[model samples]
Target chain A: SQKIEQNSEALNIQEGKTATLTCNYTNYSPAYLQWYRQDPGRGPVFLLLIRENEKEKRKERLKVTFDTTLKQSLFHITASQPADSATYLCALPTDGGSQGNLIFGKGTKLSVKP
Target chain B: DTAVSQTPKYLVTQMGNDKSIKCEQNLGHDTMYWYKQDSKKFLKIMFSYNNKELIINETVPNRFSPKSPDKAHLNLHINSLELGDSAVYFCASSQGQGAWEAFFGQGTRLTVV
Candidate 1:
């Protein structure tokens, strides 16, 4: 069986500090790995996606690194703020061939305290 | 101008009742999906429709069915809902099967009494 695991415990960080989240998977080689942010009671918003061929991708303040060798992806929030508090989910294509069929991991809850 | 949207942000109903949650996307995407988020926040895909055709169907129960009248809509209907069916259901749309980005609607939290 395929499994995607994110740290279940909440991550607490002081505002302005960098927050890093980890995502590990087993038995699936997804061509694309995507990240999303979900605030309380709201749908997840797509943040960034990195392909297996690419080592890293970046947005305004978000950075994602995909390591197929270790089967891990690290998400970093630089210059984090209180507004960055949310559950971050990592998803991949279900069958590796169907990109629309996504399988999501239990998100890592991030809390930035001011 | 919401890309994807679901109706009835909160739904409270009793077991054995039938209910439907409507979803629509104006993004002109070719694929749409339904995902369930459990109490522990584990998200899983239940169905996927592309161009109004069923493309992916997971091990979901027969009580739950997805109806895609057109390419822009995918509705989820639950019959004889059970207590275990209590979860947040999300509707999303993507450009195509091989696309990596998906836009999600604000989920509808369902409570089975």
Candidate 2:
């Protein structure tokens, strides 16, 4: 069975600092990994998606690094602001087809204090 | 306009009752999915539909049934809902079966009393 583990504890960081969250998986080799931001009572919003062949992907202040060897992915937010505070989820394709489902991590709740 | 939307943003129903939640995606995607987020915030995949066909069905209980009348719609019906079924249900869609990004709806917060 495949499993993904994230920091269950909330991460509290001051504004303007860089926040790094991790997602580690076991028993699966995901070809593609994605990141999503979910606010309270809202659905998960797509953030970034990176392939196993890509070392790192960045969008504005957000950066995602995929390490296939370790079966881990790191999500980074630079210049973090209070608006960036939300639960970040890491999702990966569970099966072969595009119609296949995604296995999501438990998610890491990030709190940016101003 | 909303890309993906679900009806009754919040649902409060009694145990043993039957209820249905509807979902529609205007993104013209070929694949749609139902996901359950538990109280602990662990999101689990319940079902997946591609072009009105079932593709992925997790180990969901028989009490739960998903119907896709069309490629853009996927509805979940729960029979004899149990107290343990209380959670948020999300509907998502992607461009194709192999698409990476999935657009999600606001979610339906179902509370079984």
Candidate 3:
């Protein structure tokens, strides 16, 4: 069976520091990987997406890197703030299936302290 | 305007009852999806519809049915809901079927009593 895993524990960091989250998958290769931010009692908002062919992607203060060889993706939030405190989800498409259908990991909750 | 939206942010119902949750997207996307987030915060895909056609249906129970009136709307109806069905239901939309960004709606929290 295919599985996606992230750090199950919460990540705490001080404001202005960089926060890094890891996503690892096994037994499948995805065409693209995506990152999303979700707040309490709300839906997830799209942040950035990086393709397997691309090494990294950036948007504003967020950056994502995909390593198909390692079967992992790393999400970085630079110059983080208290507002950046939320659960970050990493999703990937299944092997040759519905593009809209994504397998998501149990997101890692980040808490930024001021 | 909201890109993707769902009605009744909170729903409290009893087991064995039937209920429906509505979803709509104004982005004119071609594909729509339904996802469920359980208490453990594990998100899983349930169904996907493209242009009013069923494109993907995960190993979801038959009791849960998805009705897509058009490309912009997909609703989920649960028959004889059970206590295990309690979770946050999310609706999302994308432009095409291949590796595109998705816009998600504020999820509807369903609690079975």
Best by lDDT: 1
TM-score of each: 0.97, 0.97, 0.97
Instruction: Give all candidates' CA lDDT scores.
Output: 0.93, 0.91, 0.92
CA displacement after TM-score superposition, residue B112 of candidate 2 (Å): 1.0
> What are the per-model numbers of colliding residue pairs?
0, 3, 0
iRMSD, all candidates: 1.3, 1.5, 1.5
Candidate with better DockQ, 2 vs 3: 3
Real interface contacts reproduced by model 3, as a fraction: 0.84
List residue ranges in candidate 1 displaced over 4 A: none
How close is chain B to the truth by TM-score, in each candidate?
0.98, 0.98, 0.98
Model 1 residue A25 CA deviation (Å) reads 0.4
Across B11-110, the per-residue lDDT of candidate 1 in tens digits comes to 9999999999999999999999999999988889999998899987899999999999999999999999999999999999999887459899999999
Residue-level lDDT for B89 in candidate 3: 99
In terms of DockQ, which candidate is strongest?
Answer: 1
**Model 2 chain B worst lDDT window (10 residues):** B93-102
Better of 1 and 3 by lDDT: 1
- Cα lDDT tens digits for candidate 2, B15-73: 99999999999988998999999998889999988888888789999999999888889
- Please list the residue runs of candidate 3 whose C-alpha ends up more than 4 Å from where it truly belongs after superposition: A96-98
Clashing pairs in 2: A98-B97, A98-B98, A99-B97
Pairs with steric clashes in candidate 1: none
Error of 2 at B108 (Å): 0.6
lDDT of 1 by residue, A1-114 (tens): 789999655899999999999999999998889999999999999999888899999999899999999999999999999999999999988888555688898999999999
The deviation in Å at residue A73 for candidate 3 is 0.5
